[model samples]
Target: MLRVLSLLLVVQLCVAQQLEWPKQYTAKGQIILPYGDIVEPFTAYVDMSGKGRSRIDYYGGSAIVLNLGDEGQYGAMFKIVYETTQDFANVMTCFAVPGASGAPVTPQGVLPDISMYKYAADYMYNDVMSEIYISNNAEEEKNNNYTLLVRKDNKNPILFRFVGLDRLFGSHYDEYVIEYSDFETTVDATVFDYAKKFTCKGFPGPGLTLAMTENPMFEFVGAGEYEEKHRSYKVDSDFEEFKGHHSRQYDDEGEEAKRKTHFRHNHRYIHSMNRRDLPYKLRVNHLTDLADGEISRMRGYRHTPDSPRDTLYKPSISDVPEYYNWRLRGAVTPVKDQGICGSCWSFGTVGTLEGSQFIKNGMKNLKAFSEQSLMDCSWGYGNNGCDGGESERAYSWIMENGCIPTEESYGGGRYLMQDGFCNVNKSECGAKISMYMNTLPGNVTSLVMAIAERGPISVAIDASHKSFSFYSHGVYYEPACGNGADDLDHQVLAVGYGTLTPGDPDSEYWYIKNSWSTHWGNDGYVLMSRKNNNCGVATDASFAILN
Candidate 1:
């Protein structure tokens, strides 16, 4: 109540004015996601070479390079991925935003970042601001000198609450809060080292692919040989915390030692990349210790490649809103965790059904459908319980096998997180579907239209990239993700679609709701780039029409 009243009081005495910023500078701070979730501490260098080229170095061993060129236009985050267990740890992964330049560059594409120290003197023309408060510290709520400003657009009054009004580029807006500190006007030329950004395997530049060559923590004489190449080093305590975050435990001490070595190499890879400006950002997460084979085991989508395309509905992409999300309309459900199971397809199917019901009516009639029933009972439809399955197949099972039971009806009041016996009453109807249909493969136009008219659509994509497994949020795009039928191995629900920058045609993205629990991603939701079919996201898209 006090926060609201304070905002109201400020508005009453609000003096609308334009905000100013620095043309180029250097600063250090942290990026915060919504609801006060912080990424890691960062040091940013902006406007080097007088070409708007800049970089934000995250403390946890990753950096973002922006405005370098065509490849660096949308910016990219440096990440580490192991192709195979034998592969040495390096920055083999570079998550990038490769697209045509748009009218407004979103935070995802903004270089040096607004938190990096204002890169430009001019601010957003549409932004109208009112003074909120002034503080000695940018982070302090009630202090002495630095000012706080509330910048808003004509539509959303609560668009952005920027701290550090004295320092034009403290932080910005709605979904994220980029905090700034330790300001310095002096620019460092060494900050924009080519090896840090362009050297990434996914970045389109010289020897980008050669980054696969690993600086192994130990020496490898043969394919599986392991020996010390460098002096013995003690494992960092923070690495143990990283392991604990993922609940990783090794069976044998040798394997444990090997993984620790791998973890150290991965850490060194990120730390070295942060020394200079990079086009992308990278960070350690649960999947950092696992190799490609181990990560692939977690992907569960099994749509057959070379199968005939099943085009069911092709709605015209006309008169549609540029941005639409089912969650805004109360159609999409809360993000759920799938635990350690590979039944992601079932969650996608049930979510789509639940959404369709909500869209047809409203949230008053919505119910949490059972994913366990599909895991246990839908095996005859080619769904391997708790293993892997296809979303279209689950839809087929529902079409012929009657209605799906609610989560409560299936168990008591919780999910049966693993494969279980068939306890579902086929005759009972908690959520009934009329039919399930697929849109044209790789067609973003039809997919967007169908989602806008229909409800959440069940979509699949190639989620094998190590970056994808530990995506911390932002517009997730990896040049390493393959775009083919054989590549789509994870099923998720597309609840909505929107652009980070309004009126920017090239900045649109799909709101993919994952079943990997709220602990991962943007609280279990991935804002994947749209239009390019980057990872075969729209290849096997399907949705349910509630009866």
Candidate 2:
């Protein structure tokens, strides 16, 4: 009994380190997703003025602003995404506009409930940091357990940790850790008031109605809807079209056999939410235009062989690390939206250059290379701009041109929908490529080594399937997804590689960076199964040598 009392005293002392929480304060911290292996740093501000408001800014050029007016009354929960080219932010709010009576938008529970946060003191410490476990069994909150790291001086927690096993994918444990920092009380009054001038749009994510404002944290706009309308809305005419297509397919197959065929071909894609979003018309368009099915369509090559490249270096006695992510190393760039254009090739090409530049000149000096420049300039080199292009040809042109301009300088940095004339102005150039090569097909080890040594590898995949469009998370592996080099339709960048469980063969996967924007997949990226040549990721990998 005496030892237990002494241990409690020691634990209390450990948690005595107080947080400096002023009446109005600001805190900065990084939110980490262990399963996705994504780390996003954010800064949040609180204003205790008239109604009480807070704003949180993500490092990925996005933000969330909330108005805590009265008890249970949320004035506005707004998400503002910064548009670098437009020089302004795009706003999506959860509060209804004044006079929107028929469309009474109550909080559909998008944001996490902080009402329980005050209960932190009631919990016992699990660690010396004053870490305590709390139940998120609240009616609105997603069913999960939370471990919070708290400070003595303030009621606010410094970190919120969530851990669970993936039920949809193979049974793999996932962890999400959000750590706060730079806690201060000072805040700007203007932050509390919503910015009405910004581009206001619908909240993103499934199940939320367009008529009602959605919780931006959990809600996301579908890619198909974005492609058709360029923004999120309550109305989903595109979704209706997809339903019609599915109905037609259902009718085409006899009812008895329909269920069995659907079950067999779609079980692999069952994990994807994208299939629900992809319409038949859009799928056809993606297949015809964006798919990179032309190995024969590719231009000049150093060696005629289409097989694997000869290994120059071999692994020694040292064991390869189980996990590696280029983003954590500051080698990769922030996610960028490809917009309506099928410019995945250009984005992938530029991503390789950006990663290589970080390796050579250090991350601080690295800048976003121009995909617009690649689209406008690399004409005769085999790319048809937004229509589609060859990664090898883009690399070859960069080598000859000597330098490529930064996205900001090249034609004002905005992604124009159509192809423009070659605008290779050396005076405005920001980066130069020395050389590049196509990785040997079917060589996972060599591809892994190349990404580890150099940086992101540009590659192609079979994105014609509906599952590819609405990918939310998890290692994507569809048996229906073709494995041939010609089956590769969409171009993406392989940024890193890791395993769900260290040294577990089934857990191996590659981290791919997509150009479809942050709302698309797990914040503009996807995990493809490693080693099995899943979805043709290892089929056609390419890397750039940067200056």
Candidate 3:
């Protein structure tokens, strides 16, 4: 079946060529596809000197000359292909370049290197689309027969097809893909003017893919290869209590009638969080405790203040046994404190919707959903104050009964009972969305990998450190005391992941993008320790797959 399809495709190519550019000829070096607009075209030039021989220059680069022979003996032929209207236009402008003396040269400064002697005849032949072929068949090479096979409708048209005399009798021709995009354009009548802006686009032609040959042009001793050596150790310690020893303090003093002032303070005990909170479960058991005299071997050991957590800790779609297909990824947006008003249910639901919508649309530009709608309409599902509620249940409610617009929505410390219709406009809210789920245990590496492979993930972590702020490339772990563990309760999104070391066994890191505003961490992002799988909060330990 595949072979039959391939043959039919080749036949179709021949028919398309007859429909687009029917006239064909041989040329030296390169060929240009002519478009009516001098602004765009598939163009190439040939360099026939030095050891580089037949180096064709098209777009911004050049391709090597595989076979160049005397004029008559059967010069080598190159095939060009076009697939779209854009592709047709690109080739047309290339053939329009006039003589050296012609004012307002063809393509009017669109192509940089417009040569007069090398560019043969400029005509339009119909095969598949309008195309132009240039060739150098001097009388000296009259016997030299070159066949330039041009195709109009093909999947990969940005390649050059080459057929040599050696394989002309029976051997099959090999295809070469060309990767050149920028060619020089000109305003004044000049052949080699390199000052003008050149509008460049890649050529989608047949056989352009196989023309690339690996070239090793430079050589240097001592600049080659080297082996790196390091030692390892194993340290036995409580991974949960492991914290770096460093501390600084600040003082706030003021009085209504007196001047207020802040003071600088210092301390030795640096409050550190348990490494286990990081995305990758750092195998501390195999690491040497620098704090202690334990000489434990370590593997990967790269560290960043803010990086994505590991994928191993992320929950897969399979994690949710019931909703095996409900896997999702997204971002988290902030919601104002409802004060005494119960609105978190709305925020949570909207947040989840935002993420799901983003995934559905396959776009990074996420739109906020109406939370006010949920607060006013989600009866029996949400509370009425700063109190919390189940986000999943809210989602279920909204999915069943639909939601309204934020413009018609109202809620805060107070609630106004009002009924509004569901407005399809998804831009009336302020909360962002992100994927939510739990990750597998001890799979910190896999979790980081997953997040990187997928988008971001939503997680619930022990943010006991209310004032979680990271600056520069350092994670200043400081706990905030507000609603305590309750206020300590908050949700955020994890955007990306990175590794501390290129090869450290424990070097895996998570590049987490957060929504606590740009003020928190690295512009609202945090690089939690991935080694101990700390980033994957307990709640996100599992996931659901939604195909």
What are the TM-scores, per candidate, against the unseen true structure?
Answer: 0.55, 0.46, 0.32
Candidate 3, superposed: residue stretches over 4 Å from native: 1-352, 371-379, 382-385, 403-438, 441-454, 466-488, 505-507, 513-515, 535-538, 541-547
lDDT of each: 0.58, 0.55, 0.29
Which of candidates 1 and 3 reaches a greater lDDT? 1
Alpha-carbon lDDT of model 3: 0.29
Per residue, candidate 1 scores C-alpha lDDT tens digits across 130-155 of 33432223423222132233333321
Error of 2 at 62 (Å): 37
Predicted structure 1: clash tally: 15
lDDT of 3 at 460: 44
Candidate 1 TM-score, C-alpha based: 0.55
Distance (Å) between predicted and true CA of 160, model 1?
Answer: 49
> Could you give candidate 3's per-residue lDDT for residues 1-547 as a string of tens digits?
0011011111111212221211111122222211100111123332322211121223223211122222123322222211123122112111111112211111111111111112222222232331222222222212222222223333112212222222222321111112223322111223222212233233333221112111100000000111001000000112212222212111321121011000000000011111112221111111111211111010011112232222243333443111111123334444333222334344434544555455656655565556556544454544322333334444444444544334333343232322333333442343332323445544554555445444444444444331232132332222222321123244444444544445654544455543333433444456555544443332342222222
lDDT of 2 by residue, 1-547 (tens): 0011111222221323233334567667765544322355666666645545555555533444443443233344455543221232222323223213222223221113343322334334434345342434422222445555565435555666654433333332334566665566566766545555565554443332432122222222112112224222332333334345444344542332333322322221221122121111011111111122321222111111343332333323244555678888887889887766667788888888888887887655767888888888887677778777767778777778888778887877777756776667743777777666666677888678777777788888877655566466666776678767777767888989997656567658999998876756777888888757878888788886666
Best candidate, lDDT = 1
